[model samples]
Target: MSSLVSFFAGAFIGGVVAYIFSRRVANVQFDNAKTRDKSQKKRYKDIYIRASNQRLSLGPYIVAIGGGTGLSTLLKGLKCFTRNITAIVTVTDEGGSSGRLRQEWGVLPPGDIRNCLLALAEDDSSLNRLLNFRFDRGELAGHSLGNLLLLAATEIAGDFRKGIEELNYMLAIRGQVLPVTTESVCLVGRTKNGSRVEGELNITTCGPDLEELWLEPRNAKPLPEVLKAISNADLIVLGPGSLFTSVIPNLLVEEVSNAILNSSAPVVYVCNLMTQPLETEGFSVWDHAKWIAKVLRRFPDFVVANSTPLPQDIASRYIAAGSMPLLVTPEEREKFKKIGVYLIEDKLYKINEEGSVRHDSVKLAECLVRIARSAREREIWKESIQFSGMSG
Candidate 1:
């Protein structure tokens, strides 16, 4: 009985020791597994980051010139293709919250720049909603939070360009936004009836019979950085915005236009989706391209127009508003061919939930990327030919 008791007690102690040892071993294995999982996750993360950086670095350097919703829309799409984008925005806005800020704060218009920044932002959805918030009451009535932020940034940085750069980093935007010029200037236009129109608002609203448009303070200089960007661009895109208000104003700065003319990059003109009531009332795609050529002093290498037909209901609404779709006709294609300009038409339109027609960002971007790639290939071939000639 004594031997039995001793043996049973000894067995119970040994079993406890074995159980404890097993538990320790299991815990150590679990910890090792967790460590390996964390290390593997980190390694994958590093690889993804490196690849993303390489892709962005290898993207073609594209410079987009315009302002307003059109420029922002284009930026939204372009950011997906390349991080090497420079948005050169028009600063002659003299209306809305931007106008008020310009008049009151004595700063260049921030509305367009703000829009471009948001469009290229890393996380646009949340940031856009926050910055685009408008105050409907009190002293800040009719002003956007974004404009105020830009104003504050400008004040803090002590220079408009520096302020914009600061916001570029703060927003973690995919590309940079630059004002066409930092100097304060007004958009001036002359009507076909010889009536002089001053300011972007008057020029846009006065009539579509605008015979001439120029910037006030005639010698307003283009930003040096803007000129450099144009010089280094692999592709330059103009428009898809209001012709007189958003696009032409930038070209009015002689140096900017000159830079574009001299650049080896392929230039593309993105025609607007629809005509504005008083601005482009009866304009067709050809008319739009003609105006651009008139200002640019050269026809763009390519013209991208939407080929998608609008829904009848949507068309009716636009018609009622005195705006019509800017369609590319067969005649326009022949005209473009004569000018040595390639005409690229695609199903680029999308109807939002609100029933308003806009460009399909992804589709438009993809088209532009393809054009850039083609241009790049042609450039390489040309260079190779030159090299072979030198070798021979």
Candidate 2:
């Protein structure tokens, strides 16, 4: 009993010391973050030139269409490579904290869009802090300050795209972000084998049996700017998001899919790290590719796959949550090979001690630049062949 008492006393003292140190560290970090924000404003003013000041070049343009964390994660990295980027995000989400805001106010949910904007913002910028600010209590306890700002802007501007444009200006964001559709839309999903699910969150987490997903607003129109962005892009990126919800919803717009097929740009699909039980249940990387291609009138020119193996410990945690790392199948690789689609193999995931699988943004972005450059070479080759044939 005496030994046990002494051990407990020692542990308590050590824990108390650790807690105090942690709080002090946190305070220091907060101060540093504030200082960083102050300096960023001056930096942007010095560097970000107006359209007239920008150098004119016919360089490649990239359009990334999708919503949710996956798409934002990709954007966080992609922006590092090229300044000409366009993100066409989904607005059909109506669940969780985002759902409550959508109900209380008849405006597009701001959760996903807010995330995309922050992802494109300069690291430690004040704009990111403002956008991520959340209420601490009351009816707005769970609402994000950014969501309220977006709602106010949408109502005042009388246009959702215009609202985002203003926010972009304030943030000095690197890329352009647009909604998939302007009409308020909801996601409705049905299981592959059976059952119907409604609402984006419900459909995404309901089960591993989803067969198809559709938007509620059947007459929803694609934003003209989104279509224009796609048509002029030199490359388009789809996926690395909820296969149906984030990815397919954008493609569901007839004009959006048509733009992909018609554009003289390479299409690349970034496969997910794992299958979401409620959405992509039982899907392989190839299954995801096939389903997305089904929606696209033309197939992709390149596919980026996680050649890295996920840690078993992290996999166990995911299994407990009813999800698993998406495994690539041999047949799928062969199929892609037959179709002339190049598969990029790389270690892009880092399983932290906390058991969360995060995309190594730097690695993924670096890989994207290399692959994109290679795709450009291939495009040159194809165009050369066409010219040669014409001469013959």
Candidate 3:
């Protein structure tokens, strides 16, 4: 009876302790549940806000390299997501309106940069018409309105970077427009026949095919900010511009390539939709990648290439001009894969009524936003990273 009493007393004490511990555990679980619920609600709200402000986040240190309308078009798409796009445009545009401006003003080439800025400008700004308007008569016959603005601004600021800053505010632009170099840069092309051409336009006239295109000054200094932007960019885009004049010219700047090679950011090359006659005649997807990779010292990680085929009739039209459809064959993809280049094949071609290739701006923009968001997610661990969904 004494042993039985002892056992019963022990069992009773044990049960009491168990009951207290269980109550404490239950209280903690309940509090935790409440906290989780609160956190979930807050998370949902943040997602909602991010979705609404999706475009705004894209405004952080995004840099675009290359020149011409291709670079400008990309800027148009990028600006939709974030105002923070910095364009390091090529000044080797020695064609039509741009060429004339460079010759007459004795100023840095501003035509391509001007177009890029206008593309990023908020709608209905005075900066638009003022910069793009054309003159029909006078000594200024063919000069674009934007080129004049830049020239005037350059003169006033006594610096190209300063002019771009002033214009950025007035236009409510998302980022700064920087020249590849403040020094006057001329495009140099060495033909397969051993003939050397001195200007971007001259290269077009010189050839059935190009051997190599380089920059004069051989030691062109890259804009300091351009170098900084490349160093800090989460992403760098090479182009859909003229392969020789617009794209390669920037890379030829020794400092520009060095900065890009040093950056931890992924470099994406937006391949042109159509082959250009003189510069990239008969060039294929792999051809473009090979040339660019070799020149820049490292192949691009991602190539956003066009997979859409041109209509036979349109293809014929291009063929007449000695241009070929840019084929992204399996072999071509493999060639790129041999290097660090990965292919992002998508239908991003929009042909104008004039039967010329154009960029699918909306699709391209969507791709860029997706890339940025995914990159951010990977950078920040899920425990704290919140994604802003599409606002539109």
Best lDDT goes to which candidate?
1
Per-residue lDDT of candidate 1, residues 67-138 (tens digit): 999999999999888899999999999888999999999999999999999999988999999999999999
How many residue pairs clash per model?
Answer: 0, 3, 4
Shift of residue 334 alpha carbon in model 2, Å: 1.6
TM-score list, all predictions: 0.89, 0.78, 0.78
TM-score of the candidate numbered 1?
0.89
Stretches of candidate 3 off by over 4 Å are 1-55, 58-60, 124-130, 206-209, 353-355, 379-392
The order by descending lDDT is 1, 3, 2
* TM-score (C-alpha, index-matched) for candidate 2: 0.78
Between 1 and 2, whose lDDT is larger? 1
lDDT of each: 0.88, 0.76, 0.77
How displaced is residue 390 in candidate 3, in Å? 19
Local distance difference test, candidate 2: 0.76
Model 3 TM-score, all chains together: 0.78
